[model samples]
Target: MSLRRRMCTVAAGAAAAPFVLVMLPAGVANAHGYVSDPPSRQAQCADGTVECGPIQWEPQSVEGPKGLDMCSGGNARFAELDNDHHGWEVTDVASTVEFSWTKTAAHSTRDWQYFIDGDLVAEFDGGNEQPPFSVDHTVDLSDYSGEHTVLAVWNIADTANAFYACTDVNIT
Candidate 1:
């Protein structure tokens, strides 16, 4: 090869090396599990209606501590549709808030459901044969403001379990 061509090849290889090195582990890491917005350890729902930020679903096998135990299985796969409850406390009842997230699994028998203080707020059906899906919802918090707990449950009958990830929860 010509000298100029050889130099260009070497430069190109050097440039690509870092990109590959940076992206490879990320792909593998994401394949296992991940969390988007993690709450602080000292975070408190003292008023009973505290705004808990976004929460991401991850595989159980992934290292590090988790605020919510929303995982089940050896490979840390997402849960199937069933009666599984994950709870969070809301601090301020008067504040309006929005909750959003993504869901991924092999088989989901039915749609997902949202409950606030034991009341059904919404439901979602991603349809059969869909492995990955996402949804976002916003609701007034004036009624649920004080010391109430919110739960997100999957009501898919006959399924084992299911998992969900919260991308963002803005309370204002």
Candidate 2:
């Protein structure tokens, strides 16, 4: 092509460079990943039941994969909490505990129970048509101190089966 036409082509390509850059992934800018330090993976119990990490109260974000099951008794693709593990230190007995999770798909009903040092403290009821939800609970912890574990037992509402997730417990 002629020199003038080549110059015009170069100018047009330069103008489109910014748009192409914008379309590329801005890695690390908005990336979301599991909060677990060691990256918790799915595990199966002696009875062939799968469980996830011993989560703590630490502030972190995790993204659930597509078709992940939050229910119990089946081969769920996501992580489940270990009810027996506290996962953190308890320093303040009066501080309120907050627990949250996201569901990608809607469920008929979801129920969650909170336990502090193995004691039932609160319960949440997620009704039908609710896909993703969260909860914040404040409980008086003046009766205890030291390291403790806060467990969240979740299950389908009206069902006896349950799954657990945990966060580090500290009462100051």
Candidate 3:
């Protein structure tokens, strides 16, 4: 090939490289799940609703060993989500509130649990199929009024790990 032709081809390839890359899958590049509704603390940090650090970059990555109530999925980098004094946003909700989880990557979910003041208030069987992009559950909060913190747990169906999220809410 001629020198000029080779240079032109190389430049053209370089110019189109980014566009090509965009079409391919990111391949497990980020968090598999995060609560987007009522905005989990990590999600709030991710969207700039609250000022934060590294957790803001990967909100759905707070995964840890199963059967635990600690928030941030046992990941210390996102421990800020467990701190209510971090100036987090409080979502105003009704007697019945909807909890939503946004899945970046689908997985076979075992169960979904919601806790208030360290007590399990609601639990949903995940079933056998892989969860969808947006999974939601209507939780009755009649027993809970005023400011409360909800710790949500997403247990993996086929693994020993689970994802965790926390949201502060004001029920009126």
Candidate 4:
């Protein structure tokens, strides 16, 4: 082609590149699931119950390496979840609390685990099968009281990653 035509085409493509990038999704490209009920940190952000950064937009995208104990699944972009004093709303609950997950993208699961103060409180085996749109676990928190953080981990059966969520609760 002509030199002028080639230069014009190159410039046009360069001008459009930025727009294309902006139109694309950001944050975790594979955002999958997060605790919804009792409103985990991300859930609160998604529901506007609390102010957050990028996590506010993609609450279900808190995936990270397996065996992570903190919320945000070890993702720095979502470090806000690791902030214990981030003004996360504390839900009042009974001794028996049901933690639920809202899976935006279902994937084969290994098992679900719940921890309170670094102690394993409850767990459910997934049998290497994909979970439903929502999964619930009835955890007996009668042994603990007052405000506490519950870290829930969803270990995927197919991937070397897990989704993490932290819900603050004041058990009555």
TM-score of each: 0.37, 0.42, 0.81, 0.81
| Candidate 3 lDDT for residue 44 | 91
Model 2 weakest lDDT span, ten residues long: 30-39
* 1 versus 3: better TM-score goes to: 3
Q: Report the lDDT of model 1 for residue 69.
A: 32
Off by over 4 Å in 2: 1-94, 128-131, 158-160
Number of the top candidate by lDDT? 4
Q: How does residue 139 of candidate 4 score in lDDT?
A: 91
What ranking emerges by TM-score with the best candidate at the front? 4, 3, 2, 1
- Candidate 2, residues 10-38: lDDT per residue as tens digits? 99999999999999975422211121211
Clashing pairs in 4: none
Error of 4 at 20 (Å): 28
Worst 10 residues of 3 by lDDT: 25-34
Pick by TM-score: which candidate is best? 4
TM-score of model 1 (CA atoms): 0.37
**lDDT tens readout by residue for model 3, 1-172:** 9999999999999999999999987653233897899898988999999999899888888899987788777777877877879999899999899999998888888899999998999999989568778999999999989999899998888788889999999999
Clashing pairs in 3: none
lDDT tens per residue, model 1, 77-172: 223211123344223323554544333332333555555534666666656433344345454555543443344433332344443332223233
Q: Which is superior by TM-score, 2 or 3?
A: 3
